[model samples]
Target: MRMAYLILAHDNRAQLDLLIERLLGPGGEDFAVIHADRASPLWPELRASLPEAAGRVHLVADPVAVRWGHSSLVEAIAKLVREAVRLGSEGAHLISGADWPVTPREAIAQTMREGLCHIEVRPGHMEERMQTFRLDTRWLRLDPARDRRAYAATWELRRLARWVDAARNRLGLPRSRPYGLWAYGSGWWSLPADVLAMLDKEMPRLLTSGRLRGTVCSDEHVVPTLVAHAFPERIAAHRRYVDFPAGASSPRMLTAADLPAIASSGAWFARKVDVTHEPDFLTLPDFHPAPMAHPASMRGKLPVSGQA
Candidate 1:
């Protein structure tokens, strides 16, 4: 079975090259790589580093200039997913520039053979809150100026927007969800081809909708939410390992000290790894070998918590 790897990358070209090599080295001919580089000027340099065998690796044209906690991240993912679907991928794995696959090729094949989709969907009322709130007002062209006067004006506009939303909520006005679908979970996911096709079909409408255009971090809510709406049973806690130390807003950059736990976690991948800081971690003897057991065996065990 073929799998499509959709990567949203902005930096760390060397690490990304190594990851592509490993994924295509053994038992990987059927695998395809679709990438979106956040409009970095160095993308051509990185693309040149990819091996010829990486013929299946395709970099997206017209990549968005992504900002953290903005809708542009979601737009990049949408572009990658659209390209992967167009390439006729049977399954798709969404990951970041800093992410590396921990599972060996054999284990990845086994997980696909079992027909499991790796995604985390936490159950709660937060989905409702996400749909109801309007925190992404920056897209309204209210912050055109970078000066203090502009900043003050933008702040006031945001305050007014929030107040309007609050009053609308109290009055029970017609607030719509993202493409009329409930939002859910961290945006990272490993989804089946069918679900990806569904996403491709719906993305245009969602992207054009005013609700998503003005929402903050819609990437965290869009994919898993739509996937859950389509097939709730396929939603399992995500298998990517991410360490969020207490009080930290983002996942800690993984280091050599994290190798043992990462290996034992039975996860297929881990994120936010910087090879420059810890060069030895990736070269460790046990880092790339296929686990003896199937990854599906560890399903439903890991917690579903992490920033996108």
Candidate 2:
């Protein structure tokens, strides 16, 4: 029943602190692991603030600078999973720095049995082919109001660097495969320990394959594609409320007014929650504890549809 509470965090110190506090109170000993980016010194400061996280902190060494449209972030996450497995984690609860878990811990434990149980979306048969959605070239290009091509171009630069590495390897030089893919969506995820180990083992192959580099957000496709290819029958496709995307780098910021909308979505976790709004969210009347049964263990994973 060992659950590794894993957070793929970057430079959001305030949000991370609030999230950690809500998830693990003083002296609470739910095994946790944090894969903090090298660019951000937030991990040190956070560890100083909460001494409990000191031993639990598994800081990334030789940290690769991650870009929104780059595959480095995905690689970092995979590395974290591998480290957790090495440390003897049975399963992992994948979450973002901005997310706050609303479901009761006891219930979460009941539902997850070394298998996937976090809120996520299942890609339709046709959607499965869409491995990458370049935010600049595809959907973003269609929306004139939102254009992030300039920012996305940064990832393209990284892709070029990876191509150079591939070229050098062709020339008989010692080289390593580049982990540079664009990925996004559904920040919260849970995976069985065995699946995680398999993913970790396959990292090198996924990185070297040029097919996934062009995608704007590869996070969405990486796990699903890997899991589908590795263990299709074991995969549980649930379009529950757990897969809502938070408005972090989006054009708009999520606010208190969105609570009613969130409740209606039947999602388990909400992202990018401001400190001021978290207490209010906990006290809302619609907030019901997860059902005693494990099947309904995720907080707010009711069956509804909107943003999720």
In terms of lDDT, the best-performing candidate is 1
Q: What local lDDT does model 1 show for residue 128?
A: 49
Per-model TM against the reference: 0.81, 0.64
lDDT of 1: 0.67
C-alpha displacement of 53 in model 1, angstroms?
A: 2.9
Candidate lDDT (C-alpha), each: 0.67, 0.55
Please list the residue runs of candidate 1 whose C-alpha ends up more than 4 Å from where it truly belongs after superposition.
32-34, 44-51, 132-154, 178-181, 284-308
- The digit string of per-residue lDDT tens for model 2 on 1-308 reads 66677777776565565466455544334566677776677656644554345465455444455666467666777777777687777767777676666555555656667375343435443342233233232322233335466556646765775666567567886322133222223535767778878878876567667555555555665666566656666765332233235754442335667677766664455665643333455443322233222322423432232322
Q: State the lDDT of candidate 1 residue by residue for 1-308, as single tens digits.
A: 67777887776565566666556654444554545454675467655555345477777867788776667777788888888888887778888878877777557766776656688765442554445455444443444555657667666766876887788888888467643455566667887788888889887667777556556666777777777677777766578899888987578898878888988988788878865445544554332354322333322332233311
Residue 98 deviation, candidate 1, in Å?
A: 0.2
- Worst lDDT window (10 residues) for model 2? 286-295
